[model samples]
Target chain A: MNAQAADKTVATMAQTRPLVAMDHVSKIFSNGTLALQDMSLTVRGGEFLSLLGPSGCGKSTALRIIAGLGGVSSGSIDWPSSRINSKGLPEGDISFVFQEPTLMPWQTVFGNVFLPLRLRGVSKKAAEEPIMEALTAVGLGDFAKAYPRELSGGMKMRVSIARAMVTKPRLLLMDEPFAALDEITRQKLNDDVLNLWRRTGITVIFVTHSVFESAYLSNRIVVMKARPGRVHADFPLVTASERDALYRSSEDYRQACEKVSAMLLEAMGDAPEGH
Target chain B: MTSSVPEMNASSERRKDIALRIAVPLVMVVGLVLIWHFGVVMSGVPPYILPSPGAVLSALIGDWSLLFPALVVTTKITLMSLALALIGGAGFAIFLVQSRWIEIAFYPIAVILQVTPIVAISPLILIYAPTTQVALLICAFLVAFFPILSNMVQGLKSVDHNLLNLFDLYGASRWQTLIYLKIPAAQPYFMTGLRIGGGLALIAAVVAEFAAGSAGASSGLAFRLLESQFRMNIPRLFAALLMLSALGVTIFAATSFISWLALHRWHESNLKREN
Candidate 1:
């Protein structure tokens, strides 16, 4: 099966409950630019969702709001309280991966990955196994002692991913984490991320500009429009497998990509093909 | 991109660095000795006006009895003053970072101290303080204080926003942020300030000695220089000058090496590898 069929499956699954719920979220900058406007979304548990849009469409803004890094001007977010209630309010339980790797230059790969745990007063000796596991998950076990300056762009991003995952966060918010890498690296990282997600069963809210990337990775794609950014389309990929070359190359995946691309183009005030 | 060319270039670069580092000072030393010897031989200049390098060297060795004690006294003053300056400067910097109101209130005072002539202030300090050593310490502390405060303030303020946000997301307390993030972020700047302040402290101690005009009770290098001038002991004066120069160079080199070592492992300022 392909993205469309997988999305149908997820949609049916989401009918029961949502892991994250946003109600009428709006954001206006001090300079009066509206980054988001009355947007609402519900991310189901264990779902891989992508906020897809053109440049300046506020997909990132939306993600930041969900992560509580940016505040909503006029709406409420009702994230599932179950995870927090059990763990004393999961204060640092959510992790964010920025477009830039944003690794601390003064830390080794292992040190960066261990930061969240260290901040929680976990000893280096205690966190060693978990840090190693996270690094191994990101294929950076060999680079544990390496600093950010020693890593390639893709490798730095892998370190960033490892840092986020080391805490085993229930909700991971990624803002175009692979946008800075080349196509090959991006594709490879996309696969690695899907594998990690499948293995961990963690929820992901990723923001990206590429419709094809959204179709390839996300169980649900939230297509956003600019100029008071709001959700223009919400398309879910309905695939059985986490990722497969055959599913990516299938006719259904191509149609979903085309549909989202067309929706994005229209959002940017461009005429669709054969208009 | 040829391996041979890059390898050759690396070796040649190393060779050039070694040559320049050794050759520049060696040539200067040789030339200065030759100039001094010839000037004494050619000009019927009195021994007091222009002492030969040999005579200065002889005086330095022969008068070791008097000069060694003076050297020790000067070194103690320099070290003590610098220690005081470091403590005071760092204390003020921490205060400045704690409140904008404190910064506004005290930054101008620091600038005023930096701008005021040390030579001019030394006399006033000598008169007001209870003892000559105390007066000298105050003078040195005043001269060395500003750079540490200014550089540290800038470093503390220049912490990466993402890192700050990361700490906040992890629910790190204010004290944790200061100790873990702010202080480490400020290391380069603090070291820079300390390096500069180290040199300034020596100058201030010398200047204070000159202003105090005390004949004994912890008289430093400056007092010896003055005594040499008053008694027409030009060779001994040159010996004292040599000691001062050596002291200055030692302080600078020691501080620079410390800065290098502090940053060599992790910071980009001294990173040895490139991606």
Candidate 2:
């Protein structure tokens, strides 16, 4: 009876497929540049997935396509029946955190954070709590009244993240969101983003060039290659959901980083030693 | 001691900078007036041809009642025309950003208005309008509108692409994106347009008054200047010229203050860099 119960659990786990799937998608810009050709990806619901590759790999293009900001020239992206998927939900529930802070320089932190909800026609009074909550989540609660120019580069990035989170999105797309920040600030933000994802049970698809960052933050990494960009490889890290400073400093994390670096080099067609 | 030395150097440098900015201008003005006063006195140049500084000052004080009313008329015309141009320019700019085709269609017309000298257009306005004051206002409006329109359009277009994509992905409506994102982003450019437009409005007001030709004492300072010239009242002509110059300076100062108020908290153009 115990064996049969375990079998049943495996069947149910198999039934819970990826929330989103892109089937051989292609994107060709008007300038005749093929940014992506026959790229396929699957994003599992409530997982932290990172797309890691070289500069021309179209990882950002793929993320933008997933966000519906860019159009695919061919093939399709499908979503299963997960609640976090795009099925029967308005696109407003999806959020994107861009590379640069991209904060409205004219607005204070509270105003920037308040934007998404305000765009949805939520009254200022109704959005005040959520805005403040998001700011607090990013440790920018004290900066609500500060303008973007008053904030440091890291603080600006925090405000941008706060703005994205204010709407409580189901799927969060981050495209090298912390690439410009210093190492310390980047690590802190990485920790904060993971906590946010875990606490909210939100799905994330992050795009970055850093192998170490991908290994450290994501459960799965999707590696891509240039010259008509397409998915090159996929690797899963440890199955554990929790990661801490001890985990980051462990042999397991180092191995994962090494594996990702190997995958990246291989994806680049075994390019000669220089980064 | 090291920190204090740098701080002391900075304060002293700032004081020297202030002295240069103020004292240089003051000395030049005093020296130029002294030269003009002595040149006229020593050369025995007739007051009817080139009034002495003493003559100009006395003329300004004695004819204060006449000049003051004319100054008020000129200022009113300039300010009213500026108000009209701002409203019209901003409204047109908002319309233009609604579509690329709209911008292409109407932008050249605005450019043509800008390039065609107001001096050439003033006569047509004088002939068409019911009164000289209305004609002057119209001429000023034509002069002021294009800078505001062109700058606002450029500002709207210069919005960060990623920010725009974020707005789009979040399902922000066209109206919401325009009001929250585009308008605020366009502010720096709008401020630039205002500065240019302020000076142009004053010039147009004066030029239009010249074109209006003997439209009476209430026709503005330019008309008073012309009347004084015809009557060989050189001192009064100098006084009118001084009032006109003062008006231009005042308009520029007011526009700059407005720009500072609007942007000092956030914009790079106004904010003082720490380093």
Candidate 3:
């Protein structure tokens, strides 16, 4: 993790094509509410991106659209650097984490983590290593036999994260996954997510309303607006090579948070007069 | 080391709590039996009118040879109907959840069947069915079917939207989603249905037997009760009534145990609370 190697990685990342592109996507509910309006965004490979906005900003809508869980009303989504399945969606290359830890109540931690692989026709015997690897990644290796009810809120969320990552998807979409957790658990999960993103080099599109969270974890932030939800501003927020407790207290991180807060205020139409 | 004393005290307290749970019910049953025997003795009512507890017990032993076969027959009918209801109810629920149109088309018919009293319709079933056993089974099946169907339908429909989106993101096929996500998600509701349906099936079977009034060796306990009443064998009637109640309790306890076994690990409803 020297400067020269980091510089080389950045150079190559910039040169590579975007993994997915949302071009003029609009989402209108049948009841006449427009969730997203002509929204356009590009997700480059190996980037930690955050969709930061207040409620009704369609950040979650955008994430769902990208994940193919939702359809755009008028525009198209394209994957330039990832493989597509027969249904024109990405083939086992996307995972999503929800605000709630939505584990199967009937399944153990190991079984829950092994779900994606099992759905792909892998036998339980074949999934053992990868399942354990995922549990170990989330530091839940010993609790594989435990049920979700046996875990605390934070531990359940960890199991959720392990399930999401077990498939080794190229893109991970999280919609306020830590919103329900306490402050300490939230911070711990935030660091774990950032570390996982860096170690795996996967593209992350996290949806959140917290300015501090967006600023701390994301290399790039897309600030969105409500009403007819659309991107108000998109900017880079790279503050340091390594983000940890040290980075959180650094002057650079404070400045980054302030900058993102200003953009969020502007997006919410509450920014003060310009300097 | 100092904490060991409190831990031991807590364990002993828990043991005492368990003992109380078991002892209280036993005391209640024994006390009630004693009261019943004394009440019969003191009142000096004829055995045909009010059998003593001892008389009932002697009748149970005396009639075991005749009544055991009838018990087996009734048990068979109850269990068979319950099994059929489970398979049919869950299968129909899965079908209905596949599309709104199917549910809309058929749910009303199911509602009508459920709302109409089984006793009111038992005569028609007896006329239509090829055999007395089939008629009894149909009655029991009808009684047991609705709870399972409704609960399972609600459970299948209650799957978390985010988990559905995750499955879509993983490119899971419809069959895979049904097996891996929907079925597991609906299990708690299905178990609830099983408990309700199990009790209902037994009741319906006995009712159907009474309605049929069949009196051959193949007849169930309901027929024996009728025969005992006609012959003024009050103690034997009480014995049959006691056997029926025992069977009902056994079915209830078995279903509850099964539900606990399935859901104690993960489901909130079945999980043990420390406090």
Candidate 4:
């Protein structure tokens, strides 16, 4: 199928099912600074969405709100309440991967991944199989007993991803999990993450400052502007089921990157002087 | 490069690193003893005023029958007091982490204990308590409790904000947070406090014994030192002092070693790496 046709099909799919709906969300900090203002977006189930913006933008703030880690000063977040059982209705199972990996330095890879389960009263013996599976999924199976200090930057992030996935959370919220990795490692992880998402069909909301990364990894990119940060533009990427290394080097990918970069520059108030 | 080579090289390098570190400290200690030995011999200082190392060793050997019992008494008091301090300090830290009101109410009392001299309160504590051992335990607990409480409070509070938010999003209850998150996070600080507290417990026991003035038939190393000094048995006094210093060293090293074993597998405090 052509790129344009694939784009139409993806958009149709997104329109059919919304997994997370944010309605005119506004966040004002205690310092009276408006971090997010009147922003609204919908993330479809099984879709990869990236909140793309420059530094100081409220992309992270928006993610935190959806994760229930932060409260919106105004507006509401409507997550997929249907997925949660009656007792767990208020909060669904979701995992967050932070910018710095943020793995507990005092825990081995296995221990870190087993933390959520351990917190829920699952014994170590019972959690071993799932923990091992998660570690294997992240390609850190051999490093399960290794401490965070012993791992390289990329390895630590793999551990973080393993930890996040161990609970099989319905929604995976990642705040630039690969920003600190070198380009090669970041590309490898991006592919690994896409594979995981494809197999599990889990919804992923990633926040990134890089337009190239958002273009490459996301089905939909929510562009944010700073200074009372809010959504400025939303760009949807067209992808095929057989996306591969060649797909990344395709003309469509280049076009998407250029388009998102333009939107980001415009959002940062550095739009071409000629308008 | 192959992964096996790096792993093998790393393990060997670690062994060499440990050897070098121990060698440097060992050499310094040997040099210090040699200097002390030569200085004492050349100066011809009277045994009463400054007993030679040989004289102290002989006195220690000669009075082993008397000194051994006193050593056992002192050690018992030190260990018992430290155990009580650990329990009290950890309990207080848990309470402090539970509620802001409780922390604000009780934290100052801990600070007051930290600042107050143990010597000044030992006599009063002895008067009030039913037994000398109980009074000594209270004195030791007072000296050791504050650092553990303060360090642990800071550690519990200092958990990575992102990790804390992750726990909150996971719907972890307060008790779950305490056991799973707060306690693990506080382990390093608590271990550090335990190391310091172990030493402080010893000091408090000795000082309390000194202040109590050998009332009971049973007496500790402190009493032995006092008796030796009063009788002008300078070599015996020096021997007791050496034993006390050795006791302090042993307590510090043993606690630190335990902390290392517990945390070396994961924590940065136990890490041997440069970065």
Residue-wise C-alpha lDDT for candidate 4, range A204-259, written one tens digit per residue: 99999888788888887889888878999987776653555776888878887899
For model 4, what is the alpha-carbon lDDT of residue B10? 88
Q: Point out the worst 10-residue segment of candidate 4 chain B by lDDT.
A: B266-275
Who is ahead in TM-score, 3 or 4?
Answer: 3
Chain B TM-score per candidate, please.
Answer: 0.89, 0.92, 0.95, 0.92
What are the per-candidate TM-scores when only chain A is compared? Answer: 0.89, 0.89, 0.95, 0.89
Candidate 3 Cα outliers beyond 4 Å, as residue runs: A1-7, A270-275, B1-15
The stretch of ten residues in a row with the least summed lDDT in candidate 3 chain B is B266-275
TM-score of 1: 0.91
Per-residue C-alpha lDDT of model 2 across residues A93-167, encoded as one tens digit per residue: 568899999888788889889888888789999999999899999898888998888778888988988898888
Ranking according to lDDT, highest score first: 3, 2, 4, 1
- Which residue ranges in model 4 land beyond 4 Å of their true spot? A1-17, A81-90, A239-242, A270-275, B1-47, B50-54
The full ranking of all candidates by DockQ, starting with the best, is 4, 3, 2, 1
Instruction: Give the least accurate 10-residue stretch of model 4 chain A, judged by summed lDDT.
Output: A81-90
**Which digits, one per residue and each the tens of the lDDT, describe model 4 over residues B69-98?**
888888998998888888988888998878
The deviation in Å at residue A259 for candidate 4 is 2.4
Against the hidden reference, what TM-scores do the models get? 0.91, 0.90, 0.94, 0.90
Worst 10 residues of 2 chain A by lDDT: A81-90
Q: Scored by CA lDDT, what does every candidate get?
A: 0.84, 0.85, 0.90, 0.84
**Over the stretch B12-128, how does candidate 2's per-residue lDDT look in tens digits?**
998999799999999999999999999999999999999999999999999999999999999999999999999999889999988889988988888888899888988788889
User: Tens-digit lDDT track for model 1 on B150-242?
Assistant: 888899999999888777767677888888788888999989998999999899888888888878746788999999999989999999999
